[model samples]
Target: MIVNEWCMYCGECAGVCPQCVIEVCETGLKFDEQTCEDCKFCVMVCPVGALEKDEQK
Candidate 1:
């Protein structure tokens, strides 16, 4: 997953991730790509459209 500049740091993406790959902290959002399952749950939950598929592959 890719978090763009549009992120609002609302923690919604972190809350819905089943793999616990996304973490929302006081400073900002933390994403663990190794733990991510490409579930796209975070993308769907992001209200600001900050999260998106890497699409580099």
Candidate 2:
């Protein structure tokens, strides 16, 4: 997933990830692409629209 600069570090995406592959830190979010299932739940739940599916990945 792609986290844009609009991100507020609210942890909403990490909370909705079924695979628990996303983490919200003090500086930014971390994604475990290796374990991600491409569910896109994080992207959909982002309140600020900061998250998006990285199509190039």
Best by lDDT: 2
RMSD of each: 1.6, 0.8
On residues 1-57, what C-alpha lDDT tens digit does candidate 2 reach at each position?
888899989888999999999988887999999999998888888889998888888
Candidate 1 lDDT (Cα, 0 to 1): 0.84
Error of 2 at 22 (Å): 0.5
Worst 10 residues of 1 by lDDT: 48-57
Candidate 2 lDDT score at position 37: 96
Question: What is candidate 1's lDDT per residue for 1-57, written digit by digit as tens?
Answer: 677889889888888999998888877777887888888988888888998888772
TM-score of candidate 1 relative to the true fold: 0.81
Off by over 4 Å in 1: none
